[model samples]
Target: MLATIKNISVTYDGVGKSFSSGDFISGRITLELGKDCKIDYLSIKAKGKSEVRWTERHNNTTVIYHSKDKMFSIEQFIIREQKGQDCNVVAPGTHVYPFTIQIPQQAMPSSFKGAWGKILYTLEAKLSRSMRISSKARAEFPFVSKADLGSIPELMIPQHGTKVKKMKFFTSGKVGMDIHIERMGYYLGEDLNVVVSIENSSSREINKYTLYQKDSFFARGKRRVSTKDILKELGEPIPPSGKLKVTKVLKIHQHIVPSIFTCSNIKCEYRLKIVLDVPYARDPEIKLPLVILPATQTSGLQPPPYLTLGLTRRERKPTRMEQHTTISTAPGAYPPTAPGAYPPTAPGAYPPTAPGAYPPTAPGAFAPPPAYGMYPSLSDFGGKSEWEKR
Candidate 1:
């Protein structure tokens, strides 16, 4: 008699298959058997990782470069041996095991696929039985990291670029362009406003204006790039020595991938390119960096078990892998605190030298600055303090 495994699969609990940091992933594993089966163990695993691989040719040799980083991995057993009897034997029928896990709210890169690298998130289940090949099933899902928009103030500030080209051989003057945008970062499906000021002092007729977007991916010291025209506005055909100013609007593609900088071995970036078309003359151009934010904001999630303490904020030590990757794997991890807690300073307290200055004494010293610059007020960024209310 043979124990036959019919099928195995995994499914999530909710309709929103996409996930981000701090999200709770609830799912189940389904197994179908044709007959009674004796199994050693059954388990499920969830993992996220980034990998890069490419080769370079030098002289007569080919040098291969590759790297990988494991963002997170969680594994648990659904069925295993019991202290008593009959735990390893699964009777014929459809069996389901439910599970729930929370993704570590850490600074990991978003899921991406590039020419030479990719960041992937997957769920896998396995069934093992004596004297039988293990049966396995796997599924992939999209993951967008909770972008910390407020981390960099410049992301919210306006950007400007200027370019000038002096007509030398065929043309006999100079053409200058000034471009301005409201900000460097924008959410998907948002309209990007652009202002173009052109000063044409050349002998040729200015034709039209072209604006486009380009995506670039870098991996293992090599780069792959693609460009797509977003919008093109017809110029008024400025005659020699003419000036025209126009405002152009371009919509960010809803399905485009956002900018990625957290991955060490790979990077994804975007650029806005502005061009001036002139007859029989070299066109002048301008480029600006663009950052695309996720369409949906991160939802409020419950803090992990370890962060339930009454303390408003606390730091956890980093593991060996974290030190090298520079990516925090543990949720709620923070900068180290002073040896002991300092007493709260009196209202309107200062060093007596400058108004509203930080305390100078040991007992009244201000809280240590955050690991990064001007961030994590404990209440401003992540909705609530890690454990302030609880």
Candidate 2:
């Protein structure tokens, strides 16, 4: 009798590309045979595969596929990377096969931490029905993790923290570091053009560096990719700031489409930080404020956040106090300029969006510029017409 089977399910044990012990990759399979043809064995298994290669600069030593397979047990090699592995699934299955593989902490691949290339896994099902085989069922998935953005040999200067500290006894400060980009951004990935510079004003021959960064969206508690989303390079040394002017051109990939984003509030606007790695030293401490700037878009086009309200925001009009910036910060941090509401004779803003082009004003005067911060949050602006104009 001819037999048939379909709908095989596959699952991954770990949520992240990197995993520790105790995680299990499991799934199930179904089968059907000509009524009571007496079915038998069904087998399920998991496998992993990886291949890598790296070459040093100036024609130095090289490394290739550092890891191939590991002795997880007496006879199991974790079936690392099987391109032709299959599942011999069958009817009347036996043995649930509580498969649990070992994934040592060191097995975890990292960014710029030495390991590079892709790691993927698949399932192989073998079946024997009444001393015969029908077909095989299986599933495959990818484990992708990017490599480090820069080398470790060039790391020097301030390594971490946000403040630029200088010893009180020292009249001036001096230190430096270098940063380079192997690729401006990813080939088919969203990337940001970045440039960094550090200067030394002190006379001491200081040499150590640190780097730190806080992406704007995260600080504002908004929805965006985490700062750790991209790979970075913090190596290369820097000379005294006065002695050498260091400049690096590189790209950062968001690994997502439309990578460019923005976050703002009532106070000073914060940008994406291309933080530096400054090692600790005595005396001079150089502090730098990283700024995030978006690329030029088609003229007259603006991000939705810049002109509309998010799902969490409710529609509302500007309070008289908000326009004048007279509200108390103690009670509530009221904003300055209201969205779609411009200040009259504000001296230089495209003629105030052509007065009356927005919501109508109250009877007379445009209520002098609000006294708070001379800016408004992207959430401040909202209207059906505004969205329609797009």
Write down the TM-score of every candidate: 0.70, 0.28
RMSD in angstroms between candidate 1 and the native structure over all alpha carbons: 14.9
Alpha-carbon lDDT, every model: 0.60, 0.29
Residues 247-287 of candidate 2 have per-residue lDDT tens digits of 43335333322211111210112223344333344433333
* Pairs with backbone N, CA or C atoms under 3 Å apart (clashes), candidate 1: none
User: How does model 2 score by TM-score?
Assistant: 0.28
- On residues 268-305, what C-alpha lDDT tens digit does candidate 1 reach at each position? 55667777776677787787777777877667444222
Clashing pairs counted in every model: 0, 51
State the local distance difference test value for candidate 2: 0.29
